[model samples]
Target: MPTALAIAAFSPSVLLDVATTVRAADLRDWDIRTVPATSSPQVFGDLADGAVDAALTSPDNVLLYAGPADNPLGRMLDLVVPVTVDRGLDLSLWARPGLGALVDLDAPVLAVDVTASGYALAAFALLAQRGWTRDRLNVVSLGATPKRRAALIAGACDLTILNAGNELLAHAQGATRIASVDELGPYLGSVLCRSAHLDGERAGGVAAVGQALTATASEILAGEHDDLVTASAQRLLGLAPALADAYLTVLRSPAAGLVGDGRADPAAVRTLVDLRGASDLRRGVDVLSAAGIH
Candidate 1:
């Protein structure tokens, strides 16, 4: 057996399919390890602590690992290739049916997947658009998409940002989408990467992995993956067959978006940095240049 490689992922339709396909494939020196951690910190911790050889992560997190602020492990991680240029990873600001727009959310508490995650990114982006600051809301860290949805339905949150199947289910339960985060521009969701320390020796292997992911993307886009996609959704997310079908409907739809080349778009990076107002995420970056993504 080759080295066991752990790939962190979410429960979205596309990702579920990707994970299944990746696991089924017989890749060299890589006994596909699937680590199911949804938040940025948890994923990063696994990656930094050497628990995972590589992972599927966000572009923003890549930049943060390369940045110099509080991270003692800065510049140690690197993105080997991007899974896609666009994603269904849009954030939905949902409120109860009778509640007003996102602007009218007066609930005592708001929930996000994490303080520094896609949910927060989407929430803050929308708030900036509405001229509201973080201080205006009682923000709570709610773990993952499913948890956020549960909080919303239980009335534990006045508003919540949800993605993947949760957003669709929430809508069915009368949660109205008042605002969207994907519209904010350049929200790159998942990625495949190799650590900087191994890049020199494992470049070829990493590239091969990217090619495999591209193949998986093509297979799904060709519509030959309906069964695989649905099965994976049911396996990974525990979603009902009907709900899994709905999630796949959206994933294969134009709105789900896909980028098969595995290269991050520089424009996407700039947009994320600008949106977060944390341009310093790339303060001392130099390796991104070698990847030709910057």
Candidate 2:
């Protein structure tokens, strides 16, 4: 019988490379279930309650949920990141059509998964670069990237950060990208996380999944999986050929895409901490070490 594992995330497309590799390996028969999440809190809550085995989530979420700070769940949960995922899949702030330039929108509404998370901080920083502060706009807590994209196209939110192919879809719908997360310095977009309270068998499963994902990332960076990745992007993200190729370009970028080694970069973690203004909350905790990422 195959071991079943449920992994939650905003977009399952991010797991395309590893899922195919894992299936091909067949070293361990594993039923990897991809559970779609609408928000970080739902994912983390599922993780905390053991409804899900792991989550591909924002690294800053690991920092906040595991640290002394209050997360959206209202209480801290013991979480560990077994592996760092992508750098940033073109994470950027975008505006609806007819809004040109950062200054063109008058009192624009900003949509975010949550105001206190990493992406939101990046959005605020991008806006700050143009002298637009948080108070300058109406910020609403719209869940996840897809929801935000829908809101953006529906004219519900004038500005929001999107990535992982959501931005491409938004652009296809006539949205304009204002600034990339690259403008914010070193950034880690995602990590594979799970509760630290797993049993022996479950822990081993998580480790195996992490190793497989890491190997897949290494292969991707080495240019060994270009065709597979491109096809996966097209199938998983519903992206056209050109956009799928563009996403592949991002996945292959060492600067802004997949972390080939599965190791967390201290500088990137620091970037997330600095952006969230929670350096003080992270005191005495070796963020990477605590997350089992040496």
- Each candidate structure's TM-score, on Cα atoms with residue i matched to residue i, is 0.80, 0.93
Q: Which stretches of candidate 1 lie over 4 Å from their true place?
A: 12-25, 71-82, 96-108, 198-208, 253-255, 283-294
Q: Per-residue lDDT tens digits of candidate 1, residues 106-125?
A: 53467876666645777877
Top TM-score model: 2
Please provide, for model 2 over 1-294, each residue's C-alpha lDDT reduced to its tens digit, 9 standing for 90 to 100: 788888888875655445546455643566778888988888888999999998888888887787754678888887777888888888999998777676766788999998877788889999998899888988899988888999999989899999999999999999998899988888889888888887768877777788778778887787776677777878878889999888888888777888877877778877887887764545313545444354
Candidate 2: residue 22 lDDT (0-100) = 43
Cα lDDT, model 1, residue 257: 46
> Residue 156 in candidate 1 has what lDDT?
80
